[model samples]
Target: MALCVMMFLLVIPASLAQEDMDDKVFLFPKDKHTDHVSLTPNITKPLEKFSVCLYFFRDFLRNLNLFSLASPGTGNTFYFADSSSTNTVHMNQDSALFRTNMEPYEWKHACVTWNSDTGVVKLWVNGKLYPRRVCMKGSSIPAETSMVLGQKQDSFEKKSTTYPFVGEISDVHMWDYVLTPEEMLQALNKNAHGNIINWNSLLYEIKGDILVLPKSRCPYQITSKSYVDNGEDVDNGEDVDNGEDVDNGEDVDNGEDVDNGEDVDNGEDVDNGEDVDNGEDVDNGEDVDNGQGCL
Candidate 1:
């Protein structure tokens, strides 16, 4: 009996527990109809107000399903999609379209919040909050639902083949209440996490062709920054200031060299008494008549 129990425990998947998914991403390589990620949240009660946020990097501008939450009757209980011209957030089958310019093949951060009491919905993209709109006025999302990424879930059915996401997605989170502006900023910076679906301790199962991989970030970091009286080389991938501050390739002190033919100390090279100010050679206060002008 003991051996059997141990074997059964070993066969159980890690998705059954909270996972630390920080600094990781879900990569949907292609538009496979069955490819999706099923997320499990800890909420067992209906939510009157909620917020969802994620970061996505895509190359194509076609129909893309960012997040989907489906209940018994409403497939789009809370769905978010993106296109070239606009981003739409749905609540209980009703959606609000937010028109904004989206850049292709770049990482974009999006956050959506909805309150059933007021039916007001707000969308923020890359830390900029857009105009608010209202949807699903008094309806709350049922707790018995299916949440997914990469494709939309229709009443627990994965049927978003045409609108499958094609790129990388990371830092997916959801809260039971609408986050304030300061809280949202903290979420964008990874300083805050969701209580309902925390990305740091997420519980998820990968299906089909989805890839769980580490996120792309710069490996090198600047440890410290300081201004030195003596010349020092800073190779931390940042600009360095030498003894004389150079602005736009021009010396600030004006006593240093300039490439635009501005001479030092009135064209005298190093104050050595060489008459190079006017580019004409004269012998020590003696003017040579070069036939163009005579003394």
Candidate 2:
């Protein structure tokens, strides 16, 4: 009888265990027809530290824009606040875009962790560290103005509702405390390991990737492309048996049968559990089989 035992254990690192309790996740509307989603105070608190992570995809270059309010009454504007010029993060006012260009389909992951005491903000993309610039004394983000994705929140001179984000967004998670680069990377990686120092807990998890307002909140579409198979470049040796192939010697008995020219039961003739051939069987000994015939 054979007995089998199996056990399963899940080892969660201290870092990932901390963010598991964090609350404060939200998904913006996917209105590709519009330019922005209101980043209202009701949706987000003011003056308090928080973090936001979301996956974003844009089909048209014009539909890719990030809008925020720097101060009260200053009005919402693009992160760069310019349409006539081009920036590393911004695209032309009229350009066709698609999420396919952005590897990993959707914004595989994006996160913003901030600290008020030090006034430091960290952004992460695809589990990798991103550049950051401190907000000067008066340039800090205001609490009143709404935040918008895909397009500028505040109406600008050339603002048009024609171009909007046309991709999917998902796996959005946020925290109130500033997460370390290591912690942020773990969260963005979606791996269940890593340390989150001062996180308050998750706020929400907006399921799905489309928003149409009242009927749905955000305006966007969910379309997936076929996964491309990247061929392996490294060479693994070809399949073949490389072990030594040897032949048995005739005089050595080599487990051959002498009675009828058939292989012997133990490399030598044996009868009734005892060697029946001549004493030659004992003299030509190599290795004998116990109860079983030698091969």
Candidate 3:
């Protein structure tokens, strides 16, 4: 009877577990619609670290402008810029191309990993580590920025713009800590097949065209590219006219004047033996041979 009771207890809980799993809801965006999947409020811890992985395929004729996985807040943000003007990635914040140029019909499978304590951010574009430099130090994230996918939050406008994403997004995943490179690759493979592996007993799954995972910290690598530096106008040093710095306002010696026997002395007609007022001809009929004659 004791053995029978033990089996009954185990079976009851297993059945309940199956039921609970079945009850979990998976939501996905409608097909052929540009729907954004926003994270719930309070999904991230106040100051912990986190990371996110997204698999997307571009379909537009032009490459997209900016691809971002930014948390809703003032400080925490991560995005990839197509600054090269050639579909290559760049991290410069000041590149005009960054804001104006967009590559069409290019797909991306990218990941951003962030650590709040260290303030280090890393970006992986198609499993390759893209180069960048960080400027923003780790800081507490503001509570107002809403986590968004596929579009940029124009804070000044105070509304979500219709520059909606035009592509297929799947296998979105998030973790509370930085993922190792190997783990990231594995995740990518699993995502391609619409599968998620169990990590730390956390259940991960791709539900149709949407992904739902437990929120941890904001998963963004603080870019090594310093926005502060970007704001500073680069002074290539003024194009000071070549001879403007000479002490006596001397004409620049290009060697041609010396070889061609041209007058180098402020155009003063020495041959006439008098300062030709305002460069007018002072034909001193004698033709005094001053050796320095006008060509």
Minimum summed lDDT over a 10-residue window in model 2 is located at 286-295
Selected candidate, larger lDDT, 1 vs 3: 1
Each candidate structure's TM-score, on Cα atoms with residue i matched to residue i, is 0.71, 0.41, 0.41
**Candidate 1 C-alpha lDDT tens digits along 80-175:** 999887998877757799998787656788999998899999999988999999998988888888898888876665556668888888899999
- Alpha-carbon runs more than 4 Å astray in model 3: 1-35, 41-44, 61-107, 142-145, 156-159, 191-295
- For candidate 3, give the lDDT of residue 140: 41
lDDT of 3 by residue, 8-119 (tens): 7875433122111221222333332344444322342443455666655444544432333344433114343333233322221311111223233333556666565665
Q: Give the winner by TM-score.
A: 1
Instruction: In model 2, state the lDDT of residue 166.
Output: 51
Candidate number that wins on lDDT, 2 or 3 = 3
Q: What is the lDDT of residue 193 in candidate 3?
A: 20
